[model samples]
Target: MSTPYAPPAGYGDISFVELVPLALRFLGLGLKLVFLALSYPFSSTKFSLKRVLWRQFVRAICPPSSIRQLQFVCPATGVLYQKYMRSLPNKPPVISENIGDGISLHWMGPKTNKKVMYYLHGGGFVLPAVDGHFYMLDWWRNEAKKRHGIDFSIAVLEYSTYLIDCTSSCQLSKARMIGLINFAPWPTQLVQVAAGLAHLLKEGYDPANITVVGDSVGGHEVIFLLAHLIHGHPAADVLNLEKPLAGAAALSPWLCFGTETTSWKQHGHSDVMPLGALNKWSGWFIKSRTRTDDSYYFEPALAPAEWWGGLEKVAKNVLMAGGASEGMFDDIVTTEKAMEKGAGKQVKLEIFGQEGANHNEALVEFACGDAPGSTNYRMLEWLKEVYA
Candidate 1:
């Protein structure tokens, strides 16, 4: 008999700590609405109340920083660790081996020439590691084995971050360095991931059998990988291969930086994210990476409309997913719009709309059946169609 599914504990219950962030987000949105209302008459564009309300709603539900904390802290390092980290009662048929440099390969089913999935974890470009995502990872692996009936290998890339003092430089005050390294101007981590994928491709894995998936900031990494693969190295000579991937998937991706999206503007209240908080985090990120200016890697959305032109022909299989009820809906929408406008028919978008589902909830739904409508199941089905 199949084991009864239990929702991860700590998160199942609401707490003051969680409420604090939510309250702060609401407060910020309230402030922004007030300011926009007062400045609308004198403003150039008529203040979009719908946009403002929508953004505010998203802020109240899917605060970016809060989502980050849940992934890195609550699941990886908090009291709920047991619920999320415990090995499945029934171990998956696949074998998982950890390759060094924060990468791991989980091979499922009998060894055969089949598609490989490169899964990247997202934590606002900061927290969480492979272990934190084991539950969802294992679930996907098993599902792939059962549905595809072909061996599947997952290359989990461990990318460097500026927030964790893991690097030799333990200096936490280096906000500029942290920002540059953590935000990563060139998607250096994605290049490394591509390197792993290339290794598999060279080792008998077909180029057409590779699918790259990432959540949150990792979702942004998918675009970075495609952009780099198509356009060549923008910042460094990392990977020289020009092979096209089978497909790419991003969940609740943070595509733009400092744009007036739902998250950036705090729903409609400029005060939600607080210029002070933004400056503080931005400064910290920049200092951690030891970068003086962050415009190069930090702002991909601001790139010219023709930036994705090179990828038009090469990137034929692209899957972008986000929750309509989340603050990142605008990010996903805008990104899809950009791709549609730039790449024309090259990109394929699959947006999963879960009413009342937040950002973290969207991810949880991808790996676990937390959100309504069995979101993870739907996503896996989509992967099956793409890879099959």
Candidate 2:
């Protein structure tokens, strides 16, 4: 197996070196806000005034080039963990552990819980988990126990972010060396995810009791993991299962990496994340791979329906949710249908889309301090049924 990418110590901490870029990013955001205020009324997209402004802000902050340049400003997993701990109503015991290869597993509830939700967060694979993700996970755990009497622990996988573009190994100028560094990419994350599942199994948690939950790129990771389980990654360690996982919830999963799609043309302005940014992020992810035909691993939307065969061997219950306004809405719908078709009618799979909502709406609402929305309610009901 290849060595995992271990981030430099204090990589998350902001330094004087990052100040200039950070300041410039915020300044650009301020200017973008001014433009939004001036153009909201006359915007081409018929979204609400608030949504139009949000789309602009998301576009400004999420440009792959900008994120790669000012990556330190995005808080790391450790910082997110601390913030999540503080937000909890009842303090649980310290439950974080390093699970080899720079990956860490953080538990929101006690490990003694019988059921587990293994969570992978999404920030286009370049960003780290945020305060909102933790809030949403905590809410799920709390609500599950309160409403359905299901006591499940959440194991948040603190995987490495794809920060650098170090596909080239040749000697480079000092400028190029400083600007481009590959922290973790494609197969590295797949291996890390396999390690996480291996850890859970080693700790005596049955595969049938664990549900894999992911959002955005994190949701993409769930799909990647499922595909890996079926077809296996050449670089990643083998992850064998005695039984199917309890369930998997992929919300607003980035299924397709390309920018050309009907939804992209229609919801280009309605969604928060721009397709241009997604394309750039996807480039950073797959640049290091040697093979040319590995697109199936990164862009599952391109895979044939037959490629999803045997998905039932990975997870018993699958929930695929996306926002109707999201650019990848069609891809999500198509992928779900393909999964059902490939896995046959016997497979338990479902798809959800909410009108007027944009990618990962449930987590975004939790981040904004609102109660769980309709999608969250639906997911909660799904969980109750899965655990029952």
Candidate 3:
């Protein structure tokens, strides 16, 4: 039998330098809770006080400067407990485009070919831009070139958030409504972008080399895109309409929307997100934007198996990476099971065993200075195998 990995001795001991900041985080969460309780009404509140408390508790133990930052750190640090990862070499340049309302894409890597990785960021579908993922993009580019000698580009989707309710128009007609509702449909957007990538491929690039990767809700986007393609959506007409995709990867994907997962209980009091808050806020955003319940996109779990027909047949090379410690363990497991039930085949699952690694750890691993053994490496390897 193999022995489980353990962190260095005294890793649990807090240093004086780290204590003050930790204290501040606790204070922050407490203050946020007070703010919610005193100001926000329970009926209108999206998150629970307990969830806020849990976020604070976790932050005090291992704090990230902001909620967006936490999405990267929690998963990475928790999964790769003892390993030290190197920081990303350089930041990617942000490019703005007027698709319809407006959308931004963080372009990275050598722009040799249109073999791109469209990254859908994770933040329960409500958070702002994920600048934290820039380092990960840098590391991915370096690894792809080093291993496969093929230059890969990245397009980080800058979707509008319900929080900001930015009134930007995208080239796609649904952009403004999707942004306002904060109900960005994974299936719809995937088809739209895939078509766009297909167009780029037809213009010159290789269709077999394009890949899609997302984290958290973004992870869900990856699956949704594959599902959309398998279902024969018309969005492929915009692009060259290739077979399926070269590959896809999702890290810590938020699979189930209506279920009460363990993380829901553990972080129920989290200041950042309360249990069941996403559904309410996201649903409202969607209803407000679309002027309809249209629960299909908001509550994907309710969709029938037929809706995802042929997905497993097409995306046999899909890769899913998740942390064991995060609150979403049950949700991930359920999603895997649901995929098995729907696809009737084993989906690749990579569960990281880093201590304290939570929802944000995978993103954190790419940015950490001295992390060893990353799932990102595994993802890069898989991409090479599938696209080679």
Candidate 4:
């Protein structure tokens, strides 16, 4: 049977260890709600409560201590983080590989370096990496071996907190670098990812062998990176991934911020993330004070149909999975339609479990077949077919 929402064995529920952070989340959430309510009289904006609450939880961990000055606080919090990291269950061995320039490569499973899966985790582009991400990475490695007898080595690029092509002088400007945590913007994040991918290609891994996957906002990065590759790059000097990627997968990606999405309104009813928080953080990360009516950061869904048609050379195969119940469900379906119609049938769309961290638990469903016709089972089948 599909595992319950409670974390797996030894990966216990948010325990007493999390009480302090939990308390802060509640406190911060209260203040945020109060401000949101007050501002609504003048602003009249709607957002997701759960997403706003989760943002508070992430902020407690990463903090506004700023990226450069993180040394001051890492000594105290890093130890606790390490301890917590150790408690997560069934993660594959992740080795830290320094790819330079604040872009680090986390290798999951063995060091074969072939059959690599490039991944990025999502926390609205503000939070630090979570062990759940590593758990999913490990699951990908193990599941591939179990189902298809293939040993897949996953390399995830964890981009830096600050970005390069910051458009606005708002929250993430160079001047804001003095003491604030500089959450990155635009092509900068894409460039850092490309840099890491370039390092892999340079080290002799075939571009056709690398499969890129991203979750939530990380999914947006994956799409953005692929789209930019097709369009010949927004800034060629910054990021022009000349070689084609084997495939790409976006797990319930965060798309369609500038435009209106039905899911943004129905988030509380389905998806785990609230649209309010998505709207808030996306604006900050994009550094756009005024919401544009179209094409938020060249989001593929908003772009012309030609963008999807160009994916023929950018990716060999593309897999998109989104929960039918997820807030982003409509957008995923929308993008999938575009890709299927415009990009050819090289793209496949699979509807999976309910939203939230439960997507990670689908690994169990794949292993046990507790959910008949589970999405990951099909996912594994696709991998075997393509990678064979």
Candidate 5:
């Protein structure tokens, strides 16, 4: 029997101490919304009224002031995803396995399914999986069959978020604990994702039949996972695979944690991601690091091109996509070029510049209760071709 699924400590519901800050955040959000509404006509043509509103809503809830502050308001992803899965009618069989070490893998189909897409969600590594994540995953599962006649399961890994540093006391002020809070630090996510892959391998699934996929930070994790497979991270255990996986895919993968590119300056305002949120989240992730020379995994764009030399040995193929209007466009292109230089013929990249496209466009659409758009169509088709 599998271990009973348990959510992270403080999985749902906010504490009394968080109420004041949460309330103040809401008040500030209201003010911002009012300002955006009044200034709508003067805003850039790059953003539609709907897109602008959505961006502000995300920005308001995910503030740059504190990581813990965002955690306090956002629902814990594991429990919420579980609830959403249960509520789905005629959905694929759901299997919940606590693969140990506080990491949970929620399989959308049975473990015996030969083909799998190991999905890692993106929320700056701080926010948990939202309803949109599940909705989009389920939609893709159905569409994969309907559109391409491919049968596959999706195993969504609910890795722990970086809430607070393990050594920091709860009594510390949010300001004092900004950079010091290290709960669920660098190697923690890497370890958990690798464990999820290991579990799939141990269950008799061929590495050649599995494709790892992620969005934004999840995409960042996918890239590093490939690097780790090639170079190996000392802090994490290794996976013993018989052969390269079928493929890997990332949508708007946050390649570099910094915002110093021309794309950032061009698309920051029009995109859904707030510049402040990126700054704060990247700072928290970097500051929580326990090592000094960890940029090979954390900052892949800045790493020497030789670091990804054996990526073709990790996966048979790689598919990376980004929206031309997204701030991470330049970084995505840079990372792609570096990987291509090393891995040669194994890398394929697509940049969609359709009107209104932004970072992780597929996910953003699902969040707004919109149907899957071009990016989703391309990803589903790519899965079919790779698995062919």
Candidate 6:
């Protein structure tokens, strides 16, 4: 059994070295502001208060700073933990010990419950899971309990969150300082995901009662996993007969690889993720693998219409939600079309486009206050549809 978690000696503060990039970022933003002001007189573009201010804010502060590129130091850092725990003590989750499949699964509701919603978090397969994700899951668990007498068990098959949320502080700080750097190769992680689910099935949990949710690259993982299950991978056979899942959802799922969709730049203005970074990350992940640039797992857009249809047998209902202003919006919109075409009407589907919202906008607790509803609101409706 794993030991209980311990807190860090102090707040996870950034060193002066880390702040050097902040200074550089400010200078860069200042120059951009000067340029925006100077260019406003001659430019033909009409500016709104929100757009102009946001454009400036993003230009100045949202790029990949030294923090991201340099500090692949450890996936084990709990830098975001203390703040999250303080903010949401009422929604604490049960972090499982090494479940033997080498995957860290965190459960957010009734410890003995069988109704499981397996969640995979997004961060371009590189960054950490933020606190908004946990809060949203907790809210869903509470709502599910209230509406139906069911205890929703959220099995977070995630990495970064488990690093902080599950481990001891001595491990967190030392892991950061050790500066070890390595990422699990492509299909290896996917295979482990299949194995993780198999473990649950092995434990006698019903696959028919399991639902799935994910965002961004995690959403990509969802699609890949479904495709594998629908095709009857031996791992999925643990549940028998390849029966469809109860339901599934993906938020602003990153589906395209190799080429940027027109929407990436079209909607990049309000998004924090830059096209170059997206390209670099995706490209970097696939470089050492055997998969081609157009492999279905890596690039679903190029796959046949039937590939998505396969998911109908994989998930009975699939909900996809994204910010209209997100760089991946068009791609997700296209994915919905492909799924509908391929699934051949067996699956119920919902597509939500949050107007003026940016990428992965639905997962965060903050909604930018510009849209009518939230990702969580739609998620609740979808959760009820599946569980009820």
Report the alpha-carbon TM-score of model 3 versus the true structure: 0.61
Candidates in order, TM-scores: namely 0.63, 0.86, 0.61, 0.68, 0.87, 0.74
lDDT of 6 by residue, 69-113 (tens): 333322332333334544665745435434543345555655467
Candidate 3 contains a number of clashing pairs equal to 43
Q: After superposition, which runs of candidate 5 have C-alpha atoms over 4 Å from their true positions?
A: 1-3, 12-17, 27-50, 165-183, 346-356
lDDT, candidate 3, residue 142?
A: 77
**Comparing 2 and 4 on TM-score, the stronger one:** 2
Regions more than 4 Å wrong, model 6: 1-62, 66-93, 147-150, 160-183, 232-242, 258-260, 367-372
* Candidate 5, residue 242: how far the Cα is off, in Å: 1.5
Question: 213-241 in candidate 1: lDDT tens per residue?
Answer: 88777787776776666665544344444
Candidate 1's displacement at residue 386, Å, is: 1.3
| Residues 1-388, model 2: lDDT tens digits | 1123244465545566656766777798888878878887787875555555555666776773444454565666655676668656676565667776556777788888889989988877667777888878877878888999998888888874344434454122211212112235456677788788889999899899999989998888898889998998887878889999999989999888765788878886656676677766677666644456567777778788899899989889899998887888888888888889999976799998887788788887776565567888888998997887
Off by over 4 Å in 3: 1-101, 147-150, 160-203, 232-240, 266-297, 302-307, 312-316, 341-356, 366-373
lDDT of 4 by residue, 1-388 (tens): 1111111122112345455554566577678767765665575323244333444443443433223223232221122223444565854343556565545665665666578888776666654445445545555667788877977787666555443233445643453221112245555566676777777777778777888887777777778777766664544334444666778877767676653566545553334444455555666666732233325344666665555776767787777776655566677777766767777765544434444422222332322223423455556766775576
- Write down the lDDT that model 6 would get: 0.62
Candidates 2 and 6 compared by TM-score, better number: 2
Tell me the tens digit of each residue's lDDT in model 5 across 1-388: 3455545554434566766777877798889878888899987765556666677788777754455566565666666666887797765445777776656777787777899999988888777777888888888888888888888888888774445542354321332212111235667777778888888788788999999999998898898888888987887788867889899988898888778799888998767878777776777676666666678788777877787787777788788888878899889888877887877776554444434578888898888766678888888888887786
Residue pairs with backbone atoms closer than 3 Å in model 6 (clashes): 309-342, 309-343
Measured over all alpha carbons after superposition, the RMSD of each candidate to the real structure, in angstroms, is: 10.3, 4.5, 13.2, 10.3, 3.9, 7.1
Best by TM-score: 5
Instruction: Give the Cα error of residue 354 in candidate 4, in Å.
Output: 5.8
lDDT of candidate 2 vs native?
0.75
